[model samples]
Target: MGLDAFAAACCAIPVLASLLAVRFAYVLCRSGLPPTRPRAAGLRCLIVLGSGGHTAEMMNIITELQKDRFTPRYYVAALTDSMSLQKAQVYEKSLIQGEGEKIIKNAQFMQIYRSREVGQSYITSIATTLLAVLHALWLIIRIRPQVIFCNGPGTCIPLCASAFLLKVLGLGWSSIFYIESIARVKKLSLSGLLLYKLRISDQFFVQWTQLQQKYPRAQYAGRLM
Candidate 1:
């Protein structure tokens, strides 16, 4: 109410936030996943695809997952990124042809607004991120994916954040796996940094062993591409 009281309250905000963050980190780290069990067919997955290099790396990760394991895969990217969507479709088609009818049932695509356009202003980027969050939240609610996968890119941030919020709210139990870009051998990209610091990702994968050592929790699972 008074100046001194108000100042003290404001000062306490950061401390409260820090304490909350520590608790969150503890819960996330201690909440290790349940033991692996034999799963029947049809595990839903949601994969976020960024453009160009990001898309390629994500595709490689999906390929390594083995088409038989994850079923009903949903690929999401920027609405304008037709190239990435098309590429995903083609890959899905190949799986359908190679694996027969099963793979066809699992492949789907959804698009969200781009978090930032080329050379967009910070204000515009923020607006776009809000829109992306709304879209991501809607998709997560409707699809209720078992696991969500993404690699480093600005576009993936909103979706990953949305997934984290869902987890916090106990609305979804979707595991989030974030793989740092292969290009980021020494340090994480901005997006990767945010996800890691926020402790939103259940598993973080790095291509290089050095990064794994740097971020001890991150798994070094070889090169994505």
Candidate 2:
């Protein structure tokens, strides 16, 4: 290539990169802002379920949600968490009994790889976490949910991160709502802390006023459980 052409290409490369970076930053900042769009019906919702009490608390919240507005609901749990999945299924069955067959048809269940198993060493967890993140990216891309609801759960980090990536790229706008586990009175759980620190969740809620004071961004909802 000619010297002038080579020089121009090199200059354009940095300019293009800088422009892309600016665009990315702008998108990320805008994503955290309160959405101005008017509420619409039939919005897609994705709910992440954790084990035991986390699942129970989330189930209670789900029961209170306007089912008609959040159509085509998707529930995701860790692959090894059979109990959580079962609980979700039972909850859906109850909805069907109370509502109708339409409720069952609108709901879907999915399982994702756990980022780290209980008591697993951090050294080994790195690999598992990467795998989990990749799986989460695929799931997020496929689902492209408008609303994501997750309580404190390690499984949620990867999914939320993937959703945030989509938002930054301007590919999707997933409004993430995270609620800290009710058991955490004075502090946030690891998942909640990460989501808060990274500004990934559009809305973060805590059950205790003290916790909300400590984490200024967290909204105190007064014992959601």
Clashing pairs in 1: none
Estimate candidate 1's RMSD in Å.
5.3
Candidate 2: how many backbone clashes? Answer: 0
lDDT of 1 by residue, 107-184 (tens): 888888887888899987888777877887888888888778899867777777777776665676677889898999
Residues 1-225, model 2: lDDT tens digits: 699999999999999888778877776577657668777668789999999899999999999999898878999999999898788778887876556544488889999999999999999999999999999999999999999999998999999999988877668889899988989998899999999998899899999999998999888999776
Number of the top-ranking candidate, with lDDT as the measure: 2
lDDT values for all models = 0.82, 0.89
Every model's TM-score:
0.82, 0.89
Scored by TM-score, the top model is 2
Give stretches of model 1 more than 4 Å off: 1-27, 30-32, 35-38, 98-103
